[model samples]
Target: MSRRNPSRNGKRSTLKDEGMQGDPHAISSSFSSIAVSPRTPKAAHRMGLDDETEDVELRLLGEDERQQAANGLDVEEQSGHSTHSLSNEDKRAMVLLCVLYLIQGVPLGLALGSIPFILREHLSYSQLATFALSGYPYSLKLLWSPIVDSVFFVSIGRRKSWIIPMQIIVGTIMLYLSLNVQVLMDDPSNHVTQLTFLFTSLVFFSATQDIAVDGWALTLLSPESLSYASTCQTIGLNTGFFASFTVFLAFNSEAFATKWGVPHLTLSAYLKFWFVMSYAVSFWLLFFKKEKKEPLSDVDMSIKAVYKTIWTICKLRHVQLLVIMHLFAKVGFAANEAATSLKMVEKGFLREDLAIAVLIDFPFQITGGWLAANWSRGDYPLRPWLFAFWPRIGFAIIATLIVYWFPKPPITMGFFVFLIIHTVVSSFTSTVQFVGISAFHTRISDPLIGGTYMTLLNTFTNLGGTWPKYFVLKGVDMFTVASCKLQDGGSELVVKATECVSDHGKAACAEIGGDCITETDGYYMVSGLCMAFGVAFLVLYIMPTARKLQGLPISAWRVKMSDS
Candidate 1:
């Protein structure tokens, strides 16, 4: 005989039958039961369990636990299989998704990271500000993301329709740039606009490809493996960025090439190599890989309906708060992020050495992302993000100090070690903040409009970082007060280096035996201002708002759309 707990519908479940009375693993078994037996509306109604009852039960579970249970149920219902592990098909899809993301990262890496370093020597900061427009397409992709989501050739596949063509366009741009990149860089001051236009177009296509891949990822993996999509994206994009920036800089540098007994790789050669890779991957997707037909829930939405939904999402209060936050969140780090490395280079810290520091820091970035993912799976997902914010800003200030104290050319090994350590620490905090915020975004995004929703959030995040860069670069020159000193028979004359704004002016200055002396470096002022702004933002707004937002019920974040 066993005691039974009776339900409102007069249904009873005995402890003995459930193995809870005497089993040592009752807690674990209870969780298994909950995961395996999700409550449907019809079943709940039949059991006389109201919505209130369901809410009460849900409130008892932690957010992560609830998510896990929901994910498990989603998997079981969709695939009619155990939710313990991924199928081979799911694993294959993961690999394919990673490869696609890697392809997208190639041109983006060049535009964002490598090109600035390459152009810094020839172009003034003001000119570099114009070139930074190439990175804007990525941030502004949200404007057309809905169109990308809604319009597609059904026979060719929804995502594949955009991805394949976009990749091809990206490859073609790479090929075209391969022939002219050196020419553009050789006289960057005159051709900054041309280079900006080309890279902007390339990034435009790459951003569209990103929209497709993001949507495709939702359907590509089984629900059990859905969570891994972010991991794949982080890993793949970082790898491609590393290759284009660190590896390219290292091999392309004359000093590094000579030191390592390797031939210097030209930018054209690098671009050509990536172009081949891009074409191969794009063709493989076109001919060999097949897109799984999306479900009716995804396919039935019209372009108009999708756009309407996006508009509705934009209007939500929670979403509006998040968008505003994303738009301004990077203000604190803008100067440090955009100007520090370039300033270091201007101080004679070789680009090759900077690349090496980034190379050493890369592994820590990956590890930090992984660790942050784990830490974010708790009740307060944004805890890691908020916690890392101070340290990241602190490191930004430290970066300015490092740049200020940079040793003369041929930097000492000890100084290099110190630089590497600073880079790793700064990057680790950044990765943690990135991963934590991404996890929160994942938690809140509407699955019905998965691609558009995710893209909307991501666009703002990218914009937050991108929009400040141009201003920061421009501000460096604006705030700087420098003069060239020329000596004539021991009497020194100082002339403003306003004319030294271009490479030709610099050459002219040097030819006249004039030394450019900076009376006030704008880097220091901008760094200080950014740090102060970051601190103010953290204390006055971000901290309070984040705490309040994170405390909101999941339902508070959802939009209610009529099924008319």
Candidate 2:
């Protein structure tokens, strides 16, 4: 039989010469002449070649081929140590990913960070709980993520098909909101429901965009650059969040604007600005960015198959444990993360001052994320996540103390400095934990179902934080015991605030020269309980499970599809 020589593409080689099979030297020489390139040891092993077979294969290679193989091995060895190095293409992909993530963060920042603080004064804790619902779309995105992954316009590109449309919808919603958000906030008591529904829709579109971008991210950069995906996400989201929350809050605060002698910004103007920015970015992506089509694979890409894959992945014991970990991991920090800042605002802390603290904390957050990416790049990616757990809970405790001891408005410079230090330290640790977990997720995520897999994991992480927040907010109001002090004629009477649940009742209490007094602040109690849960959960569940999960082989995290 005649075979084409791989080394000399057009040359015909005879493999059936008499005695060729019996003569080992002749066979090796013949194989060497036909060989193209050497397989990596890993590839050889995966092909079921034993060490003896690999040695034989190596010995069969021609001298020049052997030298080429040696050089390839050297390059790979050097690359192992230089993962930080990125090609120009990688850098561009990183920039593109960061921009996309940053765009997602803008609306999220305004809804979750800025609006909550703005409405805290006008709305009660219960009403704020409704606004908190807007955050759920993100946490619940996993439900629809499979559809995003499985269904798309192949011509428009899998990721771009969703990203383009979602961003356009986001821009439209922002434009609509820019026209009405201020009016809604002006009478928050009467319009809280409408405001909640509006922002919820905005957040929903943003979450859908996140799923597509996440999938695209897996393919956008080279495998070596994959570790930076989480870092880009952290930096980008935080920057957008910084702009919408810290910058916007600082400018929107009349007190801050006057104090700094800067032009004041209104919510309407801010929303309008983001609307324009969103549209601009969306258009840039639609026209300039071209998504590379994914190659066909054995695994089905249909919607049913994608969802079945999700189910199969969920059925894995390790995944179930990880999901459980994601669901309850944030319980300890819930009250502190969700309520502490708003409580401080209620305690007379200026919104602008709070903004300043976040502004200072921002750099550390980015730095921490970068550091975490390095720490998580190793085999034990969850190490940093576990290490930061206790420190985060401790920070929560410290935050509680700070909130309790917070002095009245016009905070002293010393106190402000203390708050900033606390904010920076706490935020740094939190960022580390977030990035560490995210890096691990990126490490384990199956690229074939990148969108659904990443979204499923991220959904649980977000839910862990999101689900607890609403309860914590409600718990604060539920646990709080307050009274109104009223002077009737020459006698002073105290009426329970709980009895004044309605607007008319509250108005009546205020009309009778009543002053609200908190006999028992729920913030302290709720924070204490959250901390306790966090500590117990860490000691009992997280540490042990995390170690096991991190120790698992990459194959364990991947889908085990049949060859058939």
Candidate 3:
């Protein structure tokens, strides 16, 4: 009693004389004294309380009570000591999950990214406009993530609720996308022709599934397990994206070949074979029942309440700024993405070559990813970080815009520049973005509510990228009328008259040594300049954001190479 109850008298209760122990929750001796009084006391009790105390401790109680008491103690001990832990099986399952997710990226990237090439070869769509479509979903996924977060058909069990079903659906959709490419090409003008909507639906579904997979792992595993799981998933997801898009391009290209008969018949055949293997994945899901989840988080419950909490978080200044930066940063990106394929086609690359080059570029990107992963590990100053963010983006925008001025498609030169630039910019930006995200993650420490916040961040990020793309496209369409009214090639005049070119110090439509301006048009140059300005904007805003993160004062104009 003294040990379990810790009486105020500072005395220990000996269990030897008492065959059965008192309940841990039992009252102290002083309380017992208050209950019984001095008149009732007897020295025979171990605590000098007499026979009554002894009687209470002794035995009409058989093995059952003793067992129950022991069980009670065990329960207490367990409740007291319980903590997050993971078995070896958990590690293995996580690895497998990462692999599946990563692999899923491969096909998805191929399907979405190769569209510009596909449009160019088969449908005669503008390469620039088609290219913009490639990165559409990722930049827009945030818009629907909340809906994805809110509902669940499989509410119980470890793997059954969301993970297994989502995988099955994604696989099915991927197969469908594969099968429908030809259907898309059959009538390019048809809204449903290429199954773009279907493809988008799959992207949304897959992103949700990804979140669930992440939540499942985050909730079930110990903190120690979190890092490895996250890394595996990240690395794998990137790898999968590479494989699906780059590695699988040959098949994608073959699907569009005239010899393949029916627009996408070849791809459909391949998808049928690929999706069949998904059946074996059931075994992985079967045992997921053993894994358990509580409510959605270490913090926050009730969907409405969580939404309200998120609303509150949205008011934070830094968060708002980050969202703005993320959004604006991508407006330029959208413009560039839309224009890149056109640039490629003009440079003389076919769909097959584009695919091949992308495949070849994957290793370099992976290297970039690795280096980024490593480089983002340490402390950095805000000024340098801010400085670092802008220059590369500036270069990219400028380089791309300048390329618009080229006389020919400039394929080989542009590809080499793009491949190298992609590697560097991707690495630098990804590393910085992840740092900001990591900071955000730290501020919001609840594991359960993480999905919602992450989704929110992703949504803002998507809005950032998507809105810009639309703006650029709209601007292009709006300006095209004014942009046109000029011929692709110019009139060729002898310009034997020195003053034949006296129109505002510029040559007129007179066919002199070529309309003098036919080699590169002013409209394309304007578009290029706009892109360059956007790049400059990215550098200016992001560089400051980086500096703010590094905690360097604004007055300090120092550039630290140690960071770079």
Q: Which is the leading candidate under TM-score?
A: 1
Q: Each prediction's Cα lDDT score? A: 0.71, 0.70, 0.44
- TM-scores for all predictions: 0.85, 0.83, 0.63
Q: Please provide, for model 1 over 1-564, each residue's C-alpha lDDT reduced to its tens digit, 9 standing for 90 to 100.
A: 111112222111110011011000000000011111111222222211335435533453367645654554464334422446678998888799779877877777788888889888888888888988888888788788767766777777878888988988898888999998888888887798899999999888988888778767756765455556666676667777788888889998999999999999999999898889888988898889888764332133455655666776676666787888878888999998898888888888888988999989887777776777777764487898899999999899888888887788888898889989988888888877776676666555543334556667777887888898999888888998888889989899988887454466678688889977778987788888888988998898889888867765444444433332
Model 1: CA > 4 A from native? 1-83, 297-300, 488-490, 499-504, 562-564
Comparing 2 with 3 on lDDT, the higher-scoring candidate is: 2
Superposition TM-score, candidate 3 onto the true structure = 0.63
Q: Which ranges of candidate 2 are over 4 A from the true structure?
A: 1-85, 499-508, 562-564
Candidate 1 TM-score, true structure as reference? 0.85
Cα lDDT for residue 376, candidate 1: 75
Give the per-residue lDDT digits (tens) of candidate 3, residues 125-165: 22223334544655455454444444544344433455567
Ten consecutive residues with minimal summed lDDT in candidate 2?
A: 20-29
